[model samples]
Target: MILRCNTGGTRTDNFAFFIYAFSSLFAIVSPVGGVITFVSLTSDMSLDEKNYLASKSVILACIIALFFAVTGQIILNFFGVSIDSLRVAGGILLFVVAFDMILAKVSRESVTEKEIDISMERSDIWIFPIALPLLTGPGTITTIIVLMGSAVSVLQRGEVIAAILLTFLITGVLFHFSRRIYKFLGYTGMLVFTRLMGLLLAAMAVNFITIGIWNIYLSFQ
Candidate 1:
């Protein structure tokens, strides 16, 4: 007990892991308010298909998260990129998403376009942009990779997984109530909230870049 406390080992490490897991949860799933729209548009699908799509999205997110957890450091090291460099890159990606959110462009034409014939393209929907990248896009992936790097133990990993699953459930509920939220908030209100989130994200980007640079500096010494 005394030795462990002096060494700052597993207990302290698990605490840090929990913090990172929770932080990632907050950052990634903050868009739960938009879920209703997603559900309404896809209501035509059978329960099986809906469940399949949801599972696919969750699986894709988890797979991407796992990949980053395992390969993030090795990939960066092989590419001769420092953690700071990766952070800066991640920051830039977040900035792009944040800018979209701030400008109210996240759901403008791209995601809302339901022009496709539901019968014609239904099968491909779950596997394509929806699951592979759109919902869990670059910003989400980068954040996961960063968190995986910081995760210290099995308990922390379990916490992160729980957080993500909770996010998925929240997303489902949001989808269920999207129409009401949209009506309540209105388009303008949505945009305003998006912009506020964007401002927060921009600040997060600056921190990422600063920390990345600091890590690179430390690596040399």
Candidate 2:
């Protein structure tokens, strides 16, 4: 809990970063929303099938997220894209998504009804709509990359990794019991929670935009 971080050679607190990583990822990933999608997609499956798909999809999503987070800086360098620039762009993208969520609308950046309908006919759905676009889509990937860019030291990097793992772990469990969750939370309850997470995500997006702008100015000076 007392973990410290060395950011650009200056000693600082890791606790704040840990919270930021965890909360922001949780908000963007929004396991509750994923669970609702899972319930609808797997309505015909038995408990065992539902559980298996849940585990598989969560594992695959975590792997994809980890890949981007671990190699985020390398990707940035290869594309000659600065983190500051990415933060601004990613931030704006996230805000658009958050705005959708705030209105209880599904963002196409995450997934769409047509994609979900098409996915229902696929055999490897756990890999398709569930793992790929549903759970860890463009918005989630961009958020991870932006967070990865902020993590400077080994400890900070580990924190980011931990956050990704924990987020998916919870998501897996939620999907495992999606039916019960749907019964408990119902559609209305889930929408309330989604809106709250969207508000949190919107705040984080603003922070990302502000930081990116400030840093860009500093680079010019």
Each model's TM-score, in the order given?
A: 0.70, 0.94
Candidate RMSDs in Å, in order, are 4.6, 2.1
Question: What C-alpha lDDT values do all the predictions have?
Answer: 0.60, 0.89
Lowest lDDT block of 10, candidate 2? 3-12
Off by over 4 Å in 1: 1-20, 33-52, 77-80, 107-122, 152-158, 176-186
**Candidate 1 to native Cα RMSD, angstroms:** 4.6
> Which residue segments of model 2 deviate by more than 4 Å?
1-12
Tens-place lDDT digits, model 1, residues 1-221: 52243333567666666665655545544444244334544567775666666666656655665666567778878888766677888887777766766776643322434432342355666545454454566677677666655555556655666656665566555544555676788767766776776777677777777888788788899
Local distance difference test, candidate 2 = 0.89
lDDT of 1 at 31: 49
Candidate number of the best lDDT: 2
| Angstrom error at residue 19, model 1 | 4.5
Going through the candidates in the order shown, the clash numbers are 6, 0
